[model samples]
Target chain A: MTVGIVGYGAFVPRRRIKLEEIAKVWGADAPAYKRGLQLFEKSVPGADEDTVTMSVEAARNALARSGGVDPADIGALYIGSESHPYAVKPSGTIVAEAIGAVPALHVADLEFACKAGTESLFIAQALVKAGEVKYAVGIGADTSQGAPGDALEYSAAAGAAAFIFGADEDLILAEIVDTYSWTTDTPDFWRREYMHYPRHGSRFTGEPAYFRHSMNSARGMMDKAGLEPGDFAYAIFHQPNGKFPMRVGKKLGFTNEQLETGWLSPWLGNTYSGASPIGLTAVLDIASPGDLILLTSFGSGAGSDSFVIRVTGRISEVQDLAPKTREQLDENKIYLEYGAYAKLRGKIRMAE
Target chain B: MFSPARAWREYPQRYRLEAAKCTECSKILYPPRLVCPACGGRTFTPEILPREGKVVTFTVIRVPPAGFTEQTPLPLALVELANGVRLMVQIGDVENPETLEIGMPVRLEFRRISWDGEAGVIFYGHKAVRAGS
Candidate 1:
């Protein structure tokens, strides 16, 4: 019961925030905005967007990537997001309904901050292999808003990514060759309730939360699979910022080529829940048969989920649903002023 | 919240229609970051967006979010500009917010999206002004 990606999709917001605005307002010489935080500008969520809409957009693409399979054929649905719209509502259900999946399909949400998407992937792989379901859909999305003048705001972006998994699929982008997990009391990054943003120990999060966990998990998975970094063509990890993953990739001895594959967040921000899987979706867009891709996910618990995917020959004729994901992102966008950023981020007063 | 270095390091938004561009990636980013979302370089340059686009898609909200109940049935739109950037905004002078279409041409304008009454913070967001002469 081998498990692999049968379809894929992505969604990035169509708007942007200018870097100069931050520079001009924060300070001509704001040290942290300029030096420590490595974001120039990030995607500002639109008022209409939330985790649910982005997930819907991505899931639509995943279905298209799967050659427009009938929604009823899917057996499971999962949504991963730290910035879910409601505490009590299951966003997965919203996505399940929007995508028109089987009414009785398995539906649930996974929360692990940034690693939620990657973790969902690992679980989906298992469920498919166990024959618990013939096809499982995993979505990662977020409309994460960082506090004003807070470090989180600059890199926070809105977007989503989706993966449809199944067995008996002729077109396999990658197989779950192996997996590994690692954990520690890494308090590197966390956004507590009653607080709309995340707090990180800065320098500490890098070495501990990101580098240490991502490296260890990748290595453990490689060892378990009897493979090495050299065996894979590319690697995409949870990117809180552009620098963190690069640091970890170097430590794991992955070359610049491997590190170059599908770096989603730098422009998109952490998409929090959507981060890693979105990166993986990007890998599926261009990867070839026999090409191996390595994925590493680190959540602030802190935990990691690593899975290896080897593309198969059936992948060549993929319908390319990633384009719609890219189209929604690449084609059009809105530019929000600081005030709008605040409103969409839910920072301002309401009419009620 | 803007990270100049990040604007340079990542460019998924920048190069691909994200307004802010980095020296290395020819990318654009809005709400620009400290580093680029593309090249992973810590160097970044700035770019403002063109003030025009079209409604690629949109929906009307009779029941607004926490801050928009006063403007119920507001015609909100998601637009794509001639330059190929999409925005979420209110289409001013809309006859029936519910009747808005997916490809109506609209221009960009600055308007109030929300207000911070407690702090006297007036929030501004992108709005889609119906395109005219």
Candidate 2:
């Protein structure tokens, strides 16, 4: 039973943030956000959508498009969320029930910061390869909230994606042929339980957390898989910003084209959990079975995961919102003031 | 607009306006490049940029990113330092952006560009101030 993506779905919230709103408040030109940061607009989550809700939405669509899920046939359900609604309860249980994955399915949450979603995919592939039950769902979802005036707020956005791995003939959209990983005891980024948001050393996140871990993992995976850098048609990684990916590509010799395929996050801010896997779904929508897709992920606590996937040519299309591409995300505007940003992000709470 | 990554790459250069002056030629590299463009020299010598310079050009930004939103209506100037190094930076303490001149004197400043979410991890980057008359 080869494990791969049988179905895939993506969900970016309906609301969009205008580039000028941020500029007007900062008393600066919009060009900075647009040209400097390379961010046009990012998706804003609605009141009805949280991590679990978005995850369910994407997973449900993925299941529906996959020709209906047996619910009981799934052996495991893993939720990869950095912005989980609850700190303790497993988001997996909530998502499994809402998506009807039912009991007997292995339920767990993966939280390696931004790498959780990509890591969850590997786990699902392993379980399926071992002939566990049959189908497994991996979901990466985030409604990332950044502090006001901080670098994270403007770019941080909301989105989610789900990928299913099963043993059947409709089988994986791409098989995880090889994998590699790297770890360093560095704190490039971390969010304490007491803190509502994550803290990252700006330069540190780029050089050490992102560049080092991702490069090491990708090279390790490439070397292990016996594939050259140019061999992979497309590659995707956990996107924290528009610049980091570009810088990393310069090091790995990935051309502007290969990097463009995974650039949704920077223009949209780091979607925390959804940053990477959602990108892969977008890639699958356009990729063919023979296309080689290399992937890498870097987490805050300093961890990286890399995988090589070969498209199956029969990539199933999953449902999505009104926007065909994230490029149109700019048109769905609901530009907010700082006060509004605070409220939407739940920074100020009313008495219950 | 300046993220930490951009800040670090320009750290010392940002402080004293230190930049690489290609040893092969007197050509001034404002941001200090490892590889010299003028003479195709691989190694450049690091030197402090001249403090007094004229604004070669400038633009006013009504919109800014996370760290710059508060400084909206900000003027950014491309100044040619005393040493003839041209650098683009935020020009603060200017009362009127329209009154801005192409050869305005700009001084260096250490400022907070933005922070990460949740009120911590301040990202420091360099900005410019109009030199006192």
Candidate 3:
């Protein structure tokens, strides 16, 4: 029973705010921020877009590429997001119902900072392998937030990616070769209850949090799968910023070419849980049969989840089934000025 | 602000664009009427309408009602689905109202239609975006 991704899709909001737009409002140096983060622009969800809506779109695309899998046949669904619309209400129920997988499917919302998305993917695939469900949908989505003038504001963006896992060999687009996770109670980033935005440890988030966990998880995955950096065609690390993914991938003995395909943070900013998962979708768009891909996602608590996937012959058949991730990122963009971006993000306070 | 009950009752149409096709006359009724308007048919089968369509007519609402002020100048359209069923929907992802024109190809997408408030249920429904987007 080979359990793997039967279908995959991604959704990125069309609205974007460039670093200069945000910097002009804050009276900061846009060039400095761009040079440091290597991020020029980031996505902004509309007034109506959120984790749930984006999840539904991405899941629908996944189903489209799934070769006619009925929505009702999905036995379980999980949505992982740090910014669930409601704290008490489960995001999974709404997503499940919207995708037409209600009543019979087990659903839950998982949270582990940025890695929440991959966490859903990991559990979804495991359930299929255990024969607990014929198929499961795992989604990572976020309309992530940063304080108005905080450094995170420039990069905390909105996006989502969904993957359907099943044991059906004929439907598998990418077989999951191996997986590994590394976790520790490092408070590199956090937001308390009722807090509107998150706080990070700045420099501390680098070496100790993102790099340590991502490096360990990638190495552990390689060790478990008996493969090396050279064995994979592409490697995607948790992209907190444009610089981190490339820097970390190189540190792990992977070449620039191996990491380039999935390094979307330069143009997309950091979408938190949607970061590496969205990157994976972009890589899958151009990946060839038998191509080996490595993915490592780091969340700020902090932890990292890594997977080694081997693309199957069905990859080409489904590559154009839905809107490709890069096409969403590059085309039909609606660039926003700082004021409009603020209104959409609800940064402007209203009279009660 | 819509109550949860009101929102819940319309989930089938709002979330999935579900309709009913009369077994006798083949008339498709959105909101799934209890009885077919044509031929007096009570028995019908569930049908999911095709998501792609063309805008038959449209208008830009410059002064939006409450709960819709954020999307001022909202473009509402009468869309003729691929099945020839015409339904009214809010056009989404429209950066400029002037870009809208009749007979433009469009596709339905899931989006947040509105919400009650900070503590109320958020409504989700389908809205039309430019086709191929």
Which number leads on DockQ? Answer: 3
**What lDDT is reached at residue A55 by model 1?**
78
Candidate 2 residue lDDT tens string, B37-108: 889887777675645577888899887655444455678888777765677887753434776887766655
Q: Stretches of candidate 2 above 4 Å error? A: A26-30, A316-337, B1-133
Per-residue CA lDDT of candidate 3, range A1-352, in tens? 7988999999999999899999998899999998999999999999989999999999999999999898899999998899999999899999888888988999999999999999999999999999999999999999999999999998999999999999899999999988999999999999999999898999999999999999999999999999989999999988888989999998889998999999899889888889999999999999999999999999999899999999999999999999999999999899999888888889888755
Alpha carbon lDDT of residue A238, candidate 2?
Answer: 74
DockQ of the candidate models in sequence: 0.03, 0.01, 0.78
Q: If both were scored by lDDT, which would come out higher, candidate 2 or candidate 3?
A: 3
Tell me the TM-score that candidate 2 gets on chain A alone: 0.92
Question: Candidate 1: misplaced stretches above 4 Å?
Answer: A28-36, A322-329, B1-133
Interface RMSD, every prediction, one decimal place: 12.6, 20.2, 1.2
| Cand. 2 TM to true fold | 0.68
Off by over 4 Å in 3: none
Give one digit per residue, the lDDT tens place, for model 1 in A1-352: 6788888888776667765565555564444554555555567655546677667767866776686567888888888888876677687765675566748798888898778887777787789888888788888787776667766666777778888888865756567777788888877778777775678786787766777788888999899899988998989888777677777888888898887766765566677777787787777777788988888988886888888888888676774534643344445555656655665566776543
lDDT of 1 by residue, B1-133 (tens): 2243553343323322235567887666565667876787666765556656778777776766665543456776777667565556677534346546777667553334454343333333346765532
